[model samples]
Target: MASGASDCHFHGNAVATQATVSTCAAKYQKDLIASGKIAKSWAAVKEPASFEQIDGEKGKEWKVTFKDPAAADKSKESLYMFFTAQGNFIAANHTGK
Candidate 1:
């Protein structure tokens, strides 16, 4: 993952072709895993899914924030995914240290 800073894009569901988990964020998580950004172990880190509306470069977008399992240090990390209301993957970020 591109640690620390956040990056955004306007992508589509076709770009998210690696969904292995069952959560709503699976597609986004799968993309991270496929790109070797996040570890495969993170596939187990699925919980605390929240929804929100954000102002995207194009317009408003739907964003989902999923909390990963605690790290070895007991610190929590989060995966933020932005998508269209139709469930297309737009962008994602893996935030943790």
Candidate 2:
């Protein structure tokens, strides 16, 4: 199915600790993906993941998670997006039904 998801993914690596930003809010994330204007955004977003540090390196896991209960309002389908450690845009349905 074609959706505003799988837009970006950022693998945790040495270079990622520089403090990057991602769309952690489902509604805003989907909106950015649709408009292709995520980069130009300067909004309030917490995180789209959570993680556990390992071997002195950022764990290969999500350290934060983004969500918006309203996405389940039946009027909208939420989207998740982020940049991988390899620096690629990825958006997807993190909540696999």
lDDT, model 2: 0.39
lDDT of 2 by residue, 1-97 (tens): 3223243343434434313434323444556656766432323344454422222133242232444444434323233444344434343444421
lDDT at 61, model 1: 60
What candidate 2 gets wrong by more than 4 Å, as runs, is 1-14, 23-33, 36-64, 74-78, 94-97
Candidate 1, 12-95: lDDT as tens digits: 342221131224466567678888886676778655367776677776666777775554532436767776544455677654
Task: Give the worst 10-residue stretch by lDDT in candidate 2.
Answer: 52-61
- lDDT to native, each model: 0.55, 0.39
What's the TM-score of every candidate structure? Answer: 0.58, 0.34
| Model 1 poorest ten-residue lDDT run | 13-22
In TM-score terms, which candidate is top?
Answer: 1
lDDT of 1 at 90: 64
